[model samples]
Target: MRWLFPALALMVSTAAFAGADTLFVGGFQNAALARGGSNFLWYRVDRVPPDAADPVQSCIDARDPYGILANYHRAGVRNTVRTQLRAMRDAGQQRIATGIVHLRAPAGQSVDGRYGGTLIDSTGGTLHPRIRDNLVAFLRDVYRAGFSELLFRYFPQGDNTPVWWTTFDESLFQENWQLIRSIEPILQASGLSYRTDLGVEGMPRAWFVEALGQYYIDDNRPDNPAWSEYARRIWRNYVAEFDYRRSVGFSFVSDSDPVRTRARVRHLRYIYMLADGSVRYPPLFAIDIYGGGTTDERTIFERHHHAMADLGRNEPWIVAESYFNDAVAAAGLSSAMATTGRQVRYFLQWPLDRGIDDCGVNVAPPNAYEAWLRRGF
Candidate 1:
């Protein structure tokens, strides 16, 4: 009974029922606030060292001594996170969602492998013990921070080297599932509701079917032999596993490449409908509109929003990530917090006008903490 309603379901219901509501948005920084002209913020807890003549020393210096001490010493990072959560609560926001990357590196690790335990090892691999005790410590900190909702990024394909989709293997999938199970107790204890990002590439049918017992198919790829079988199994599994009243959903990533984008969109729509001809999942689609440095700002927003509206007619949609340097560079677009703010505002307003609800902002580092607070306010 306690697991009856996932946090995201509650959010969707609230948004759908509420009319003329202002979406409190936050992202990597004030961009969310600026673009949407809404009050919201998302904080980033991870530390990246500043640049210096000696990159290693600079990286070491960049580590937040207060954050580290707060985690390693004192009540630990969780306590420090609580302090930040309190700040947001004091600002009068009833709901707060925290974002944390589950990462691992040996003690005293630096970038460039000059020092051991860098983000990626010599073999161009992410740190092992990917989900470690420190992550538990961080989650405890998140709970202490007074957050009841969280957006967990299992593997951020964009920032991580080689990308998750490119290197995804059976071992990685198993590791991720193990981590999820291990943290379930903590999540339940903290009363935290979570949403995870499935990378844009969309997972293989076998991986999802084997891991979660359900696989999301890209509507764009309807003809793929794998999708038909996957769809069949999903229907059978859904009836056996989930309560119909509870909302089930998945995310989709749009690529800049026309061919890839079409394929993704087609596959996503196909999966949106179930064998019974009912909308099996909430239409909470996500697109990577960051442009990767090549898309025009207006064009990127317009195309992605229009695409989502076309596919997500009766359901809500969210941007999994936004305004990354690579996206901008790939699209040949130039944007700042102002541009980001405007786009978010447009997205929020569009849905409200159409009588639909629910949207989310992705928050990352540097000014993430500040952005988190701003959104709540």
Candidate 2:
């Protein structure tokens, strides 16, 4: 007899047991193609020039506009900002989270490069006029989308490059917050709750020092003071824009060090204190775990899991991004599935057992087994 696994039933059961907290396990599929031999496809509506065609439509007609916009905002394509928001609503995804920048490029020029294209002009001035108009249009579309939640990620992973890292200035950073303030009215009108990922690496020094204290900084000063200071300021300004005292949530990505992860989690707790004396809003702590044969990837995930469990005091945790490299290609589907399944099951059982509320799996497409795992197999 052919039997279908009651995947949704299991998910419902798990979710019920886990209470209101939901575990979001999905892939970061590429817009243009499927990964790993599965139908999972990521729809990207941003980054490409407005005049350029959407490559994913050719393969999969159905699109996740919210996902696309989230990715695009990180990539910095402002032209299609409104179009993407509308697409998300039309595609049945009401809530969305997007990123913003304090600067803009000249009219007719494209900021098509990764991590939301260059925001500053050649002379190091804000791109307020150009970006403001685009943002107004974008926020209007977001309002039209009927979204109830808006999560803004100030420092995206792609922006980890030296150029983006070093270029951030206090004035420009404050301008970004100002942009958020200007758009708050639209968000309020839409009845959306706003959250942001103030990843530890992106926070400002004063805020970081205030939150994590100088001891933590001295312990994990991987980069020079300038770079670390810049990152901290980015994090601070991003968080400062939001009223954490009110039910706003904050997220942070883990550094490679286990000690640092624990320290970051502690710091986030301090941020929670500043927000409201209680950790009401979700505290999203993510760690990058790339799965491959390399020792570095394995080490990263191992340390991440240990650190999370070590530092987790009933906070929400997510494996923000994970990639299976070419080394794992030879392992085939069965091997890959077994390994991936073991990891997922481990996180679900161990952390959830310890009272952690949420866990997310990030994957690419074309892997049927991985897709099954994501669907909660």
Candidate 3:
């Protein structure tokens, strides 16, 4: 029987000896690509960069990560997917964790070309059929293009390869759920893969719950029967759509925020109960603590630690993304973990990412944090 924390087993077992117990550490661009052990880096699978610098090989030269968290968005074209995949193989990157950053069109926006537009039907109540067809075609192309060994957010049974999976830079809006509902079954049916990183963003806090429509149900706040019941209905739909496959799990990514952390943990517990104990994979919570150096990450992180414990479950977590170039923020994050008895399963650094020029938040080159990060790590 598959047990809970299959991904956690891979992470915790390897990291236990490190004393810090971080399973994977990595982030947006070249900074994370240089670190050893499991690391994450973003790529625009739709096109190859024209740059002369080869960061992937440099990372392998330092040490092969247990796996690479290859983050991408759903808008990528298939030809670019083939091009990028070939490039990665040529570069000698074997273990890969493929994640879609934003699965659906951002609220009020739409995607161009083959992947189609919004997933919602005209009534705004269900998934559009074309979304599933497009997704299936895209994934089949990916599977055919020499990506047989895959890693999802939840570790699948009989697959021992360890890869860290997490969502980045997007919140879990209702549309995201609709997209998952449409895509997950196709993955399972074709046996291409299972388990997608349920994107949970911390910056949105109350907006996250309110937008997710789970406020009274799993927010750990005072209950309102009507609201709680509505939340339960939503959870029921999630369970029905997911069908207890052990294929879906959580991977949080955002700048640190205590309220969001508390609500997500409690929310997971409620989900487990609603599944009638069918949900087995432990939802791994990770944070992408980003700032321009003014945010008090330490205090926020400390609150996050306590909030997890206060809810009655405490598991080793991941510092999935951070601007580790800032010495003060880095030190504060480390100290908070030590003081709170919370062990890190991974610590990834986010430096200026030159690979994807479209990224709004990428830090430009000559970053002082790069020098500081290299010296500090």
Candidate 4:
């Protein structure tokens, strides 16, 4: 039985993970690199575009012939997304949509019209009529924006199209499961769309279970409970979201970590494998590893690479974000390339569009960090 585990794991991985590398520079900081035949570019919709034009249009203008991954923070009520999609279609740019959407249940008002009642009531439910209406309006907005095509960017069946869309950015579980539970049925009834990543926290003891497991639930979960209750909360919070999303339409919902330790990565893969006994959920993962020459930074990269390889020869994952010293940008690139799988499904470095300087990497060009990336490509 012990030996059979390896064979079964190999079979699962071989069937689950397969695709060419898809690297993305965090933003348009090195737009020229994207233009000069390097990796694809990523950007947030609210951020100003390189040409100071529309965000979607500026990305298309890069002439990458591939596409850009976009983050949307607005409430899906955009008046101009239709025009933007037209421009994108004309250029044949395949845009992948991500980013957060804050859909809270409508607050109840007092008779005096001053304050409110409990947002989530005693029922442990959130799908009020108003909440349902809000979801409907949002879906209608999405339909008008032509975002259904954008959100459904990946092929539902296989790993050949490993593009990711972490739907709620880093705020997925933060909004309470009751809210998400309400949203899911609306998503189903509205027939808005399907297939997205759940943007969950990576650092949790639920990922690990030696012969004896440790207890570390996120702040969103109950603090201390009996072992059975602890297990139930973990299943509800971490494990059940995948099945719920899959039930609606999501094919490969991903879990991302900061990539600080190999254990986190290994355990996440373990959780994905064990929970997904049927292999319905591909072992999709994401990591964040800032690169540099320092021992701490280099160790971060090394440990992540080792952990990423635990599953199979070519497990597709994303280098979601990073920061690197210009002096050792090549070393950083090399560190990013240190994983068992030669392919990088997606690579989006940090602060690609922000004006502020992040560890010397900024929006302005002619910076050492941008130069370093160009040299590597």
Candidate 5:
């Protein structure tokens, strides 16, 4: 599924008042973060940057300045992203895309703690002071790095790939959600105590915990069905607790592979069901279009585009994470640039073509993207 945090419930409200069926306004809910309308940008720095300035900035500059993506695996990445964001602001880019990413415990590092004799984690050794400091420090970096939202996707892959979870079942699902809930209080308290505007909010996961819980039902385990159903019931409760407008959900085009497509389709259906039949209630959906992994780029793009024709049926959609893959390898740099331009056209046109409240597209390859932006594609 998709993932992070920039929103939570019982906090200040920023959602706009719109009709229930409509998903976007002028292609976005928040104009400031969306930059100049609904636009997408690159997600550079999969890991930590060696320095603050990105050497590839010249290559990846695009007009889609709504937001940038990041991960918290490496501590140095925060510095690099902050530097880039400030530079963008200095360059007169008023929108100043708020960098977004996740902050989770590293692999195999079981962090446990006790709250003044109240045990925090199953593991007994990790104390409250240690947990508070580490969690606070990591979250504080989110404010320093200029990230607008955070998604606590401890398990990165949407449909339960389970990097952090030792097992892929109900037990892990329960533990992870509990941990996320616990971390929220710490995040809030730390932000206040330190006097940092870390107003960091939560992002509804695309499918993370809920999906894994669903798997237990698929596995045909007795009693686990009730457990999984109960998980969904509770998730519905929590999502209701947190205002739905502040959350965003992730989606994608169905692949030619029937297996993945079936899984995604099922997940999509569940997301809708989770909304309790309210079109306006589910987290806003972002359509992911990373082209050409196992087939022609255009073919992939078209299928995804066509598949999502009814995506608007469930909820409003955005070209959440899209880019012309293999651009550098096809023809030459200029040809790739031209191809990128065409892809950009298709994404932008879809919203106009369908006449739905298309949220926006976030395309990458900043190296060639700036040129397309100049051409007004």
Candidate 6:
């Protein structure tokens, strides 16, 4: 008989981890890397630590389970990433864990990636070869750098600013679909099993997607039947784009307006409804749990839960980010080891009691998380 680890009841989205459910962070800074499980370093092309010294090497030194390179891609920023990959190799740590973000160059900044004028180029039924070649080149760089455990975050909230999170309209959705089509080959070529996340701002419903697709360019369809046909076709195109798993990601801002938050909930429900009829709630759903809320975490989490239950199927949700926020209850005011230790255990078990999965921790780990590993949890 094959040796088996005790069931942890941890839920991972993929079959690859058939026997184990491990902990990880969505992304992190210097402090979190020192902890354990998975570490995410923002691959900012513009800002590499001086002298090619890798920030991740130290995480490797600490022997963290995974090193995730979260790409915050900027134009003409390849060298910094390339240099760091070499640093990883020198440190004898290849194949960094990563979350692939396929986003455009925000509103301003150079459109340095393969797509031009926007994240998807001309925004029609065509693929840009230059962009495809560029994507190929970038992925090649990723491979050379010894990166693995890639999670492709579909649709970027990218280089996104506080002024705007992400605007989801009809045309952008189609373009993102095409964007996925353009890169699937390169992603496949990397020779690593990959995970994918799905999301769009406001989490628009199927009707919205249908309306936007049908009337976005032209709402002047003279006949009512023609409009229905157009809307149906549009929904098909939009839904067809999602070839990956059923998943959604949410982030909380410092804003606490109940009206706005509730509106956002409605949009997310739309996503749930559409998927329920088809993919049926892809195994993994992630939330970036931040602190310093206008509303308390408990209230917020319950509200989101109610929305899901309203949709008729509520699976275990993943707390993909936590304790890293400046105002979070877990992190508190200090980085004291003891404080975080207490906080980590309290929250991890707390969410479990509420049907949420404690998946990723942002920032660093406390002795508490380490203690779980020690106990074979």
Candidate with the greatest lDDT versus the true structure: 3
* 4 against 6, candidate with superior TM-score: 6
Q: Count the backbone clashes (under 3 Å) in each candidate.
A: 47, 20, 7, 2, 22, 12
Put down candidate 3 lDDT per residue, 1-377, tens digits, no spaces: 01222322344111112322212334312122122111222232122244526533333222211111221224444455556555544433322334332232334543321112111221232334544454455456556654332333322211111112222212222443454565566667654533344432311222234555443324534233332333333445665666443332344444344555665555555444454655343433455555443456677677777766887657665554455245665666656765776755434444333233122223211123332243222
lDDT of 6 by residue, 84-196 (tens): 55654453222223333334433443243323222333234234455555455656776665543444444343321111223324454455545555555566676654444
**What lDDT score goes with residue 329 in model 4?**
37
Colliding residue pairs in candidate 3: 22-344, 22-345, 22-346, 23-345, 24-346, 26-348, 195-247
Which runs in model 1 stand beyond 4 Å of their true positions?
A: 1-76, 88-148, 156-171, 182-185, 198-259, 270-279, 288-298, 312-314, 323-377
Q: Evaluated with TM-score, which candidate comes out highest?
A: 1
lDDT of each: 0.34, 0.34, 0.39, 0.32, 0.31, 0.35
- Candidate 2's error at 7, in angstroms? 44
Least accurate 10 contiguous residues by lDDT in model 2:
348-357
Give TM per candidate: 0.48, 0.45, 0.47, 0.43, 0.44, 0.46
Query: How would you encode candidate 4's per-residue C-alpha lDDT over 286-346 as one tens digit per residue?
Result: 4444443334334555555565565442444444444422334335445445433244443
Count: clashes, candidate 6: 12
Residue 90 miss distance in model 1 (angstroms): 5.1
Model 2 has an lDDT value of 0.34
Candidate 4 lDDT:
0.32
Of the pair 1 and 4, which is ahead by lDDT? 1
